[model samples]
Target: MPALITEAHDSTRLALSSHNPGAIEDFGLIGHKVAALADLAQNYTNSAIDSSELNRLITEHFPWWNDSTLRYFPWMRWPFKVMKDPSTYLKMLRHKVGIVIPAGDGNARETAHLITTLRNVHKCKLPIDIAYVGDGDMSPSIRAFLSRLGTNVNFIDLTQVFDNTLIQLKGYSSKPFAILASRYPRTILLDSDAVFFANPDDIFSMYQSLKETGLLFFHDRTVENGNTPVRQEWVGAQLKLAGRLPSAHLANNSLFFRHHIDEEADAALVAVDKSKPDTYMAMVFACWMNTKHVRETVTYQRLFGDKDTYWLAAELTGVPYAFEPWSSARLAQEPLIDKGFPLVAPVENNLARGPAAQVLEGASKPVSQASPTIAAEVLSDEKEAKSIKLLATDTSSSYDKNQTTSRVEAPHSTNELNFPRSSHNREFHDSPKPITPNRRCTTHMVHPHPDGSEPLWANGGLWLDKRDRGLGLANWTHWYVGSRNDEALKTFCETSLPTDSPNSKSWLTSEDGEQWHNEVMNTQPRWYSNDWGMDAEGCPQFEEWRWQSLNQGFRDRLERMIEEVRKVEAAWVLELG
Candidate 1:
């Protein structure tokens, strides 16, 4: 092997020194220009050589190429002229692989988790190298953990390099900056949160296919809308701002393959370092490179969507890409396999359990039997209409009087009776009563066996229909439970608290029950108002009534709206907090 000619650490100095008249430069005064010219000549020579002689030489010495010359670039070609032989350059490229991972103070737990998981679970046939760049002191715990993985890993502190510039520009904590800075050609930059979901053989295979194409970028399924040709202009603007590439190229960075190592590529990398060392700049740089001669690829997985701001940066960059379907419909069509590996398992225990679960549990309950008395009384027409009128006339009074009392007397209340405390209570106090016009009743029957056991229902069991009243009560309870202010607290106890379930009455307590209720109420409503916004005229009522309802009727309509807002808030909090 020809001895490797390592380039200077300062690439700009190397470029400048190559043209300096005073000191001698090893690669000659022309620097990269000379290298480019030499490559052109070698390519020309290889192309012109006689086929018969060339075939004989290649067969005897380079049997790998006997099958196809297209597989190997001609050594006498334009690009190969700088190198002594094409095989030598190709060997150098093949042996070196770039590995990247993000690290920092907040991300340490997740980052460590990812590294450990990758080391233990992911089995790669190739002896791939690993590189980690992040912020903060290299924790001995993480360093030692990674060392045990049986791979050579390099750690670079991003904060030391940027001098807080990155902190000011993008406000990203150090870990992400280091990862973006250390990216090299022909390397795979994996995010700390990204677990190896499958054997990456095909992923690597795709990378190899882009060898001639320059850089390869993975397409996220969710962010593909930004990858459309029209979005390329926006991507180009970012690249131009970074001074890496002129307008016309775009790139994204969920997953990417870097092919060619050139000055422009180097410039792209530096641009990423200087201009907000986040995923977007990296994406823009990639797009700028692709506009020249880079190749890009994307998977069909929806998991790759650019739903986040970092993802937005990538979509702006125009590059060759593909997207894999990870959408609900697509996932349903081709379900995941449950292999021994954690990646394909049905339950991913590796992910951190977020606060959402706690919030959900505190706010919700599984389907259970509705109180028999309320079911019967509420179902009756004369009693039901009277309750509706009461609600319409004075919702606050009806809610406050009934919410706690109904829960306490759940077993005795009947479908024909209005809840005892409200104004409508007298109408159904003792009557079997006619069914309400629009109101529906649902019955839930519990059976007891003989042998002194409870008796089962002989005829068709209790029928239960949708309950708007119950939902309204639940919403009110939630609002009060989540009370950050006096009004919300009042609303929860008086308007939203469920009247049918005695267990739900705990929402009125001053203990952990109240805390749980408040968090659930607070989280969803604030998230919705900030993300979706309520109209000004009804904003106060919207805010108040939003948390008071827990009925299927209200939940079915608002669940998606709530989730969307929550997701946006969650994304911001995860990165910012």
Candidate 2:
């Protein structure tokens, strides 16, 4: 129990001794209420996920698909020269090549383009796996469109299998992958937005490395934008409401590689039933394992340089990889060259010449290429030079005659040059349009009093009658010290006053006046009254006096309490580790 409870109970008894028996009983009731609330918090801290039910739930919801069309691909042919003691699992036969596609609603065009590009890369070879794990109803048109492509594609509709489970767990959509990891260990998880610019041999390499670790985590650059707090608080609220607290914190949407399934994974699935299932169960698994295990077994690796660097390393090193936003420059220069543009095309030329030049110039920008402005001028000159050459060929006979030759200058106009007038006009006219800044209102309105004498209902205002004011102050004092009988204070303040009672000013000198005065002084003391006086104690000297010594003692007690809670929290962390 908290020390605050004991201190509050003793203080309330001493302060309310002169009150009626009913009032004393009310104070005791308040103490009981506070203790009950504390007990609820403790129970929540100790709750955890049930493992047996979780495993059953996962197996029950597994999706069904056409087995004939679905081809299980093996990673046997991958270059394994650098690996030490390569697993025999990688050398098995079947489809050696596979493409992983993450599917969602209304992304058929992008997915189609991705498939088209992948088909182009593989040159009509290798099987493709289209993994769809979202909840929106998709049209048959999109499904048929993808199937029409020559590549073998498998659509894993997560919604069909886990319909009931997803409905039960509102936020945790990542459970399917957790279950999938244990069932189909070789499958790759891809993001819907990912585009394949080059061959994906590096991706397979990362998967091999991740198989050694129990789990793999990706780093998201946007994680710093308060996503951690938002997710943690979201999970924390669910835990608090379900009488389970202190779950793990992890980001969703990053790639994860799961090597083995254990008790902690099952526990996480149990928790998923109580709330919206998260898209990434690896995070929840990490949190649950951390709670129950002794050593950290989970591995978190970033996929890209800075953001993409780690991902790149993991891919190159043949570990399980995660995806993040990457710059266009990361793509291989070969594919860009094959399409037309040289390996090193001038950046300026590509920008000035537009998409046509971009396609012709290839993936890399050349070192000797002119700037956009210079390239535009050079291109214009080249066009004019070509025109001159054509005109010379047509008029060569006329120039060779001995007769007096007349020189004719051709008409030159901006329109005739075919310069982009609309683009130029837009650049000039649109440049001065001021960016509309977002407006924010920071003012807060205060509620005013009807009588309007310093807003009597305002803080420190004389809104209540004298007796009511005293009761109000006393009630606040009781609660601050940790008492639970707030009803008694409310009753005392609502009681009527005597008809012939003198004005509030006269009560300052009466017998009860002296007592009330001392109460007020004790409740709201001056800064100069404390041991430190004005120099150290800012205001309310009595509180400052109590705060100095009491705060240190409170710290010591809280430290001990926290240490005990840490042991409970650590149980989950240890399990995952």
Candidate 3:
């Protein structure tokens, strides 16, 4: 219960960090945190502490650690120099959560729609901070219009808060800025186009994962060759150079150093607690990755924009973070109302409907378990090719062409997967030889509530197709998903915070933690980094998949949300009219 502002106040004052000058003159803000850290460091002055203990404590208090005590993973290698911790500082620090969304000229319409949906449909009461680059991106007229439109909304200008001298506010980089700039201790960061079936206010309460780690990032779809050489080498080098220790998250990440897994992080919706020293440091590093020099040099070119930086920073900082156990999924071009959607989507676990049943043809699927990560259990029996080619065709052409004139045999599921669907999909899939489905057809990334009860949200807007807006409102319900190997994740995934201490860091470096870390890393399924996390373009296409369909109740809820957002947009002022 320390009232601490973990932001780099000392660094910003030095005029060395990218934050503005004299960011927080009030030393009172970090008073308790400083006192607590001092007591811990002074009390633990035993000369014989091991490298593991040293690294753990450094992450515990940061800046308070003595650089001379380097047993392993030298904190000095990635030092916390004068970084401006998002120019804004909170006077009182407590366990509170709020929302941060990046908005401006590019997505003003969607921003309006999102705000309306959050306030009206889900009825989320969380305060929202709408962060834009500057007045240029957030025109005064647009700001006025949004203020008049939204409730509990605050605006933050990145240029004004962080020192824009080094980094330009490109859309990709704005995520970290908005997140760090939030006044709340915990931040729910979202892209304007995000559509949620559940109330965001329920986020801090619904999942055990969020309570345990304060930082939960969702995954990108599982695609082959996701680990590329350039990204792999860079991250690998950084990890090695820093002499980083192995943690369970690294083994479970999309880019597991060696290209064994996928290669991305979906930023559409991210949850983080900046009050934690480890997480605060991770955000600073993530922000630096988006800065002009770093981003232009290797971040964007090697990785997929700013998507992967969040986890990578956490990994490098040696902080505890979580990516939901479930694999990423997406909506079909149409709703379950048609054969095209059900035929190609992961086999829905619900009873099939009229036209949708015509295609499945009564090959009823088994009822899938209520498990959160069903990607592996529901995957096709086919040993999909490691690589598939992507066509440059537009969304309009792909869905239309796949729907008409083509009737496909469903890919067999690995388990008793039928909840509703008569069978699995033929499009964007493998197993039915000669006909290659578009594995790269995944566009709108999806994440479900860990319990599989309802969709938490999906990125890329509510439009049926972002590429072809004319198709009308999208009712994306089904998902093709994957998850990390369960056996490997059991050790670190959603582990309860150690009861003895306020945070998990205390016992993490103790004898039991050290033993557990060693046992888990050695026993995990795959233990090689032969493949880099990714190449310039991570995957040509991906293959293995599972299907999870929301129930009719969710579908009904989705329709209501879509209709509500549309109404909000209908009243929106595009040009200050």
Candidate 4:
């Protein structure tokens, strides 16, 4: 049982209460001590004492924390209750942590590209923390190189924060720990290979509010029909094994224990407010799922790395979380005009076209990885400069030739590249004439928001397809768009989980019934590659920009991102010298 003690000075009746024996004893004297500090503060405010005198008063009362924080003092640390080796706690109090990126040698080049993009292209003012596993993955020379890539980039070694006994950053493990090691009260974790159409800060607007739920997660591609009984059976058993009740959130989940649902939570970007209690507890579960034993034994085997665990942990802890309404979409470079601008109707795109971004920078490199304004290849194409821009840009606004280079245009449709449509380009103009969109071509998993608000970013770097990584493939332009919810699963959840059956409350389930569980376990299942939706004719969808929809912005941004990456690549080569 816990004892309760009250603060003498605070008017709202604050209490010092805890079930932990150490907490009770540690905080028992805190209220009175704080009350005395309040009097001392009042005396100083009233000019009753000098700064030295106030210092003396504090020194007289609390000697242990006098030099630490109460005078200059650590909050939620010190005096009564001491924390266990809280390495980053004080760092958190001092620094404003913004975007947290977990980098290693494989993704070092991509991470450099990302940092450069944030500073130069996105103009992200938020401080960035680049966390790596250890010195083995990111050497001192590499760290020095990255440190010079952009401003306000801080490096954190994950080993110092987490026990080496519990984690090993091979495979799909480092993503979760990066968030766990963040010094920010609110953490925004992004993979190193990620690129943005909008500034990094603005993506938060896509969420309803971080207040109601301290976390926001995006769903994975809903590209396939739900026929995953093997995985669903495991999910149901995991929920039961953990003693989790079917909370309203999971009870009506479209994926959990259901056969016809697609994957959940993309995890390209994870936004969490660690200051909230619910988020704190939920984070514990998330980290646990990513730990060695659990992740190796089941999590990685069943789910796609750390992607689905964010939502799974949140639900298991019963902490509310929000998801973006739009389902995911895949982007690919438009085929050349000579190569065929528009495909024959009803043809599927290439299977190599889909898979989110990832950092292959396994070895950190020199700082020159800073993306400059333009690429050498683009600069070399000066003869075709005006011609390329004629296709990519509408008006020949005299631009900074030094910072900008001519783009190489794929011979596209006549109506494509018709530009100067103002930033607000929702209104349509068909004078040049638009191609009839193949209805089947508007596939799901190819839509991301980035209109007036610039609400889009992607994990894969400037590759048309990630498979040809490091081969310098062009950015993907033709995107598949459209998404749908599982209406059938919603109906089934209502029918199968009956609340009136027994002693149930707050939800439909009156018992830990296995009826729905059995059905999910017995259904036939199928596996899906990320590029499963490319079956619809994916031929050069954005060859010509549509007046009503401006995928044109993404195409333009892609050019800029590629240019920056080239600059960084040159810098890295120079470092080898």
TM-score for each model: 0.31, 0.29, 0.60, 0.60
For model 1, residues 177-269, the per-residue Cα lDDT tens digits are 333344332345454433332233334343332342333332221111223322333333334432344222222111111100000110101
Off by over 4 Å in 4: 1-75, 78-97, 223-227, 241-257, 337-447, 450-455, 470-473, 484-549
- TM-score for candidate 3: 0.60
Better of 1 and 2 by TM-score: 1
- Which runs of model 3 end up more than 4 angstroms from their true locations? 1-92, 225-227, 252-258, 333-442, 483-546, 573-577
Query: What's the CA RMSD for each of the models?
Result: 25.5, 30.3, 17.0, 14.6
Error in Å for residue 354 of model 4: 38
Please give the ranking of all candidate structures by TM-score, highest first, separated by commas: 3, 4, 1, 2
lDDT of each: 0.27, 0.26, 0.52, 0.49
Error of 2 at 211 (Å): 5.0
Residue 108 shift from truth in candidate 3, angstroms: 1.2
